[model samples]
Target chain A: MEDTNSTIYALKTSAGQERNVARLLARKARTIDGIGISSILVPESLKGYILVESSTKIDLRNPDLKVQHLRGVVEGSVGITFDEVKRFLKPEPIISSIQKGSIVELISGPFKGERAKVVRIDESREEVVLELIEAAVPIPVTVKADQIRIIQKEAD
Target chain B: MKACTVCKMISSKDHCPSCGNPTSDNWSGLLIITDPEESRVAKELNIEIPGEYCLRVR
Candidate 1:
């Protein structure tokens, strides 16, 4: 059941109007016929451009697209792959200042006010696996990197 | 030593008390939400505890 309407295209909309245009496109797709639109995304890091995944190339002159004064895709660029947007879509860690063996305090989770040691770092999830040094059993818990404070450094 | 970029809670401890997001010394605008339930701005920002907070964290 492969669908022909599976290509992703880009649109040039006004900066900060991305969400609005996305909402409009979503609504139009639901009510219009042969819109062939599958999904729409407006990345925060990127402004003035919205990515639209659809089976067919959207017509800029289509009234349902609400392209009044809103820009559309450029010529010779009708399809884009995941790799094209991956660079801008990837998420970076919230707190990259942490180091291994550093003593950190659990500040917000169930183990609030408790201290722990950095056991491992999971940069992809922006989380850290910590060994609770203050606990009787020394439980290991994974939490957001920002959830723990570096109480002491390994050097000290 | 840092404050949460999301919740803006400041701490010598390095983590935010409200939200578990990262806290950084790279924050500006000091604030204290003692009554997150009563303070309009605190409620607006989703702060729910009495603690030192910063307005912006980079």
Candidate 2:
């Protein structure tokens, strides 16, 4: 969404330090004069970058706001649109995309790092029944939907 | 850290400092609003207070 007065600018930050840069920038924006930073967004999906809403372009040269992990503002005259960032604002449930017969890798718990095939999905409970791909016996294992990452979808 | 179910503001206490709503540890995404009035992002999310907030709270 475009506002008449303010624009959204993307700031390049060091990987794994988006939150730190955003926090430091917010603190600095409050103390410094003429820095019209309105908001800071650190989307988990977008690493090494944070979006900043301001009335004018942020001046990182100001020593007060020189965050340690901040690389610089993204080079572009045109600011990012609200539509472009909307997807990150409200993330969809992880379970919605998972389907039966999909290949997945266990991300957490005792079966971590094991590849498995999705057998059944319990949408209400957000759980999935998976069969270990490498196991000698086809044992059905139940896991939380979030515990597995989809590796491949079942062919139509 | 816990997030208030009502306002989604991140805090250490059980209840939200601003809304007094119960907070949950299961929350994700970090949004910081510095200027509620001038921020379009904050407006879209319906966030009024300027503080740390989570995008999703379970």
Candidate 3:
């Protein structure tokens, strides 16, 4: 799925506003003629930037396409390759990086904000068995992988 | 926003307007196709409609 004709450019945007910027750019590209903006990508893992695919270089200073939260094109950028954008296109599962005995912080549910040690991982279910570090007794609590953030990796 | 399970098109409806598939709220990555005819990304993803889409839907 490589495209040699169109070049991928990174557009800087305000943090937490990548979706808004992409939406605005999409609307502008449709209304304004000859902007050459083909597609806009807002990857969850990639923050503070959005990818724009175009046949030619985009002029961000164009008054007609002034979109809020859109800063400008990345400096010294000569377009990104398809290989670079491939990871964003198909992101790996959140549990792929987690390991047993890793220290994690729960971000949601009844155990929200609690620190825990990963005891076991069920890849098929996408759930993790964790032992709360702050609890009095070592009780295993199962949680969805997405609800926990890895705080420290288990020492090799 | 919800994403169609079949087409991955992002919308607020329970079913996709284009493909008539059930929509899911568990989705990641945003892809907006402004011009599908000119977009190489759109072509690679095989998206014909010009609209917001999700790269991954669960």
- For the predicted complex of model 3, DockQ is 0.73
In candidate 2 the C-alpha lDDT for residue A49 amounts to 93
* Model 1 lDDT at residue B46: 60
By lDDT, the best candidate is 3
Task: In angstroms, give how far residue A108 of model 1 lies from its true place.
Answer: 21
- In model 3 chain A, the worst 10-residue window by lDDT is A1-10
All predictions: root-mean-square deviation over Cα? 16.3, 1.9, 1.9
Report interface Cα RMSD per prediction.
Answer: 17.2, 1.4, 1.6
Model 3 lDDT per residue over A64-113, tens place: 66899988888674558787887888789999999999999999999899
Give the poorly placed runs of model 3, Cα more than 4 Å off: A1-4
Q: Is the docking of candidate 1 incorrect, acceptable, medium or high quality?
A: incorrect
Q: Which 10-residue window of candidate 1 chain B scores lowest in summed lDDT?
A: B32-41
Top-DockQ candidate index: 2
Native-to-model Cα distance after best TM-score fit, residue A115 in candidate 2, in Å: 0.7
Score each candidate by Cα lDDT: 0.66, 0.88, 0.89
Give per-model TM-scores: 0.43, 0.91, 0.91
Candidate 2, DockQ score (0 to 1): 0.78
Quote the chain B TM-score of every prediction.
0.76, 0.94, 0.98
Write out fnat for all predictions, comma-separated.
0.00, 0.87, 0.84
Clashing residue pairs in candidate 1 are: A5-A55, A6-A55, B3-B23, B3-B24, B4-B23
Tens-place lDDT digits, model 2, residues A1-156: 445487788899999998889899899778777788988998877889999888877777877668898998897766787888788889987889998899999999999999999999998877999999999999999998878999999857
